[model samples]
Target: MMKSFFKVIFLLALTTSTKAQELRFGLQPIQYVSETQGPYVDFFSTLDASTIAFEMDADSIWHARFKVALSFEGKVDVVRFEYTSEDSASSAPLMLQKSTFTFDDTKEIEKRPLEIFLYDEVSNSDWSFSDTLEYVASDFWLSQPVLLDDVEEVPVNYVKRGVSVVPVASLGLPVFENESTLSMYTEGFVASGKYILQYKLTDAYGNIIPGTSGFARCNTGSTPVYNKIDFSSQKSGQYEYSIVMLDSTGQAVAERISPFYWYNDKADEAAWNGPEVSVTRAVFENGWGQWSQVNEYLRMIAPVATMSERRIMTNLKDSEDTARIASFIVNFWTDKNAMDPLGEWKGYLVVVDKVDQEFGSRTVPGYRSQMGRVFLQYGAPSLVEERSFDGRNYPYQVWQYDQLKSSSTPVQQNQVFIFVDQELIGRQYTLIHSSALGEVKDHKWQYHLTRHTNAGPDIDATSTQYSRDNFGERISNSIIIGNQGTWFDRF
Candidate 1:
């Protein structure tokens, strides 16, 4: 019996020694507890991995309540216990109780412990658990705000809003050369607001040339008001210029740059010859068509006179030689094989008469009107597509050219003008299609569309496809002109 008992004891000791051991690590100040009553107990539970618990000395005489408030850098669970002393004054004895605590996701605890003095119910106090707990907490990740101070950079070639320069000198007897005023007029340069203008002139080598004469910059209130910069002294030479505008902020807001050349052939008579002129004088002195005779006379002198002499003599209306001069201009560009000797001259004469009847507003004749100018330049378009828009729909006009030499782009070098009969005063025509003049090369056929009411604030314009190789043959070509609506409807 004694041996069996000893064997049992040895087996029990071996079993105890073979059991698994547990190791624990913990965050300090494991838990804090506060209570309104004496002898309160608090319990803190961390992840099952590792933990350490702490409490005040159990032998202390102070009857402080253990109101427990638990918090953690990570996640944790908690419980509380209350112990009351048994007293003989009452028949029921004080008992110990327990409660579980759960917390929502938050950096701080939603509920805190309250201390109530036993003698006074109205006197309650509260304190943060972090302040009471003397242990250091782990660092947590947080978000912070950032600041930016650099200015945004944009391309120097950035085009400004509502600023564009278009072609203007498409037709007419070169008003640019005849007008006495030294002015620089750009067709499409327009601005609705106040702007300051600055300009620079440069030579062909792209270098600024000083003391070249004929340079002046005139300021108009805004663009499309026809601001003129005099280059009278700059003389007939090629030079590029840039017009820069500034906003109220002193920043460069817009720029208009282009190159132009002025050739003065007065010093070189050999180069001063103008277009060919053929004259046919009437053998009988009959003034039935005296103007015809004058035109022919001018044509005969066109190829022989110097540039200066032509400029002076062409404007001489009261000279004794006026009749002879008129005859020369009359026969200019005549078809020798025509059944009527004056057929070609008669056609052009009709054009001049039409301009006078339709567009003559000021002292200048109808040819000066935007419409008349185009009529003479292109020699009556093969087709005329015209429409009027009240406001809500599209309105346009198409002029078709079957044998344009440049490219297959329609309306490649054409111009469109918009005018309001209501505002039928000076400079009523707003020039469009100014950019089409020199930029396109493959245009053989062209179409022009104006897509808005003649009096509206906004107008949209575009061109059509063109062909070069085919002429007189029916080509699969269509041109659109309008103010608004779909492309097909524009036709």
Candidate 2:
């Protein structure tokens, strides 16, 4: 029998903050098998620093203390996290505090109620969280991979199986240009065998990023598998990191998956120094079908083609010159390669295939659909906020991006695209507004979103300026960029 573990409700909401009085944090449980302790679960919790109340003491130093309690079955356990201004140079804490509590069961557990409570004694404020602890019994098992900020051999209380680890307070991880590795720690229990640990990092939309997936050989004896993968070539967005344990025959025995965000604003600006290969005109004509196939390819590139190329493609639509169409296709991809240093046409071909699968309709191809066109042109958004079930607004989605990776125009950062499903079926998400330079722009976007619902006298009802946690509450009120008129002002 084979087993798989997945939690559908496991989602990370970033780019938003909570109200001043409220509290926010991330809680995760990683289960592992120990030789002496049998099976145990390590529950890791990280507190958001924004809501922590820091008071000045008699020495004029700021200090904060949070009382945390865990209740399971009929027993209760507790831990505390304390911080001081001397820890960092900022008024507020520079980093979030994380604490770990272990539950030793020594046996398999199903769905067991686990309640956690956090209280700020100074502010007289309290927050609570509840989650389930699950562990499957198997001869060969792998622990849940914990996303960590750092892992070292230094001895500390946070050290569980072996190495000391600092977990990211939040699930999202921003990848910088200088960052080289995405670190994670896991454990495996084996009866006996040679195995290979395979890892793959893919985007949130389930598309595998090129060169981000690989595996290494391992002989099993001890647990606590500390591994790192090359994160130097990734772009900005939310991604899923998955690991699979393979037997000697290359068959997968166990697997684990975790979600995190990656950011690299300057990844496209890298230098491309390599041997130049000459392009042959006949190369495109021979592999491609005649004029009919060439016409479809021309239409497919409309989302990324330049204005001049688009005008020329329009005139060349009727022409039966197969060689000329192939030339245009080559020139189109070549020009894009010049602008985009790290991206490739082959990788984009994979995205085109994905567009057909996700955005295409029976009547029209996905590339032609407004949602598909935006996706193809701008690439995937960093965070896609979908409020489909809310009765106050149409089933709309907000796709926020750090920057558009591939576009005809030179767009600025923090652009947004809004799409709404009017019919509420058939996946027909029409594009109503965008913050990009050349895409569709509707000044009355809020009016359209709230046409069915009553907006009353309160103007703030239609505004989408809520904190990062509440960013998906309503429509945007202010213009994209005020005086500049268009979002893209400079190259």
Candidate 3:
């Protein structure tokens, strides 16, 4: 039995140029083991929008016609999609497409030849990028590490899951010319499991570079990999970055190693280790002001702190050694900005203050609330659409992010979070649904939103958003009256 899941995404500002006879593309294949459905492979592919020639139709609407075919073992499956760009095709950079293949054998490891072909209808150009699915399954699954290069020095500011990848086309990898840091992304799967994740950078001869190795405790289906190393001292050479996952018993269960070539033509680019400042007790004393403030600030950064940092914070919660505390603080932010510890600290402080002022209440500081923690940890949403009580169902708000990035995960674009005010009194918006990976997700979120009104999980979809009689303002378009419910700006 085989199944295919197809998804398409378009971008407005993805502008690029290409010749008429070229169909620039790339493919990234990821494998996973589903608890119920067994094993599956997902193929994520992208095309340079410049390679796509969009034509204005009779109605003045611009459309791009294209088809992708996947073949294996003499069997072929083609997916045809009509992509719409309106008037932004010229500036659009990449068009993302996805397809999934499931295995009926449920084998832990399956190796098969897979061929991908893309045909450009506008230019009559076609290209083939063939790959194989060599999957190995264990108690957990670790995907190939994808290296994303910002050749233009412009951060895309948005990411679709499994979409950031290097191409096999002529664009080629950057010369390490503009980027100060490189981002490597990967995915993992476990049925509610935890593992120790480690990343390392090694030279051509396999020597581990100093300060290029770190580990963190990751827990999730797609566990977030967050590690940083010093890239300043790196000389021009071939390097391999490895991702190792260890079980609870400290045994290496699975590892993905990828080799890459790094030629830093612009090694002279200005390095930013932050403004240098002497580390001393005065640095701690005057920076945080009072001893009480030092302790308070230490307690405040728990949401973004790593497991090791959290442990240190646990031990430092009591000690009165302002100098040691200051040193710890400096070392912590130095990971973010070597010398400018105050830079990261001060910026985070601003976010904390905003969270407190907005989400805090008379009894509970905003940071402790669900909405406030999300704001602090995710750095606020792109928009918050608040829905007040309609006298039938609970009041809920939808928090949407144009792009959401965590200290552990890469940027996730078009992410959404939904919170419900169960009691409908205290304004404590509890998180009920989120599309962000590793976050809580409830498929029956609509049922929960109206469950207080006698709706059950098995209720039909139509009734979940409306009254029992199926009449009243649809949940999709409910407007808050008097224009005074949720008054906070998106900031």
Clash tally for model 2: 6
Candidate 1: segments with Cα more than 4 A from true spot: 1-288, 291-321, 327-331, 334-341, 350-368, 382-433, 436-491
**Candidate 3 — worst ten consecutive residues by lDDT sum?**
479-488
Whole-model lDDT values for every prediction: 0.30, 0.60, 0.59
In each prediction, how many residue pairs overlap at the backbone (N, C-alpha, C within less than 3 A)? Answer: 52, 6, 7
Residue-level lDDT of model 2, residues 25-56, one tens digit each, is 44566665556655555555555555567777
Sort the predicted structures by TM-score, highest score first. 2, 3, 1
RMSD of 2: 12.7
Of candidates 2 and 1, the better by lDDT: 2
For model 3, the stretches where C-alpha displacement exceeds 4 angstroms are 1-283, 306-324, 456-491
Residue 49 lDDT in model 1? 15
Whole-structure CA lDDT of model 1: 0.30
TM-scores for all candidates: the values are: 0.26, 0.52, 0.41
lDDT score, candidate 2, position 330: 61
Which pairs of residues collide in candidate 2? 15-468, 16-468, 16-469, 17-468, 17-469, 175-263
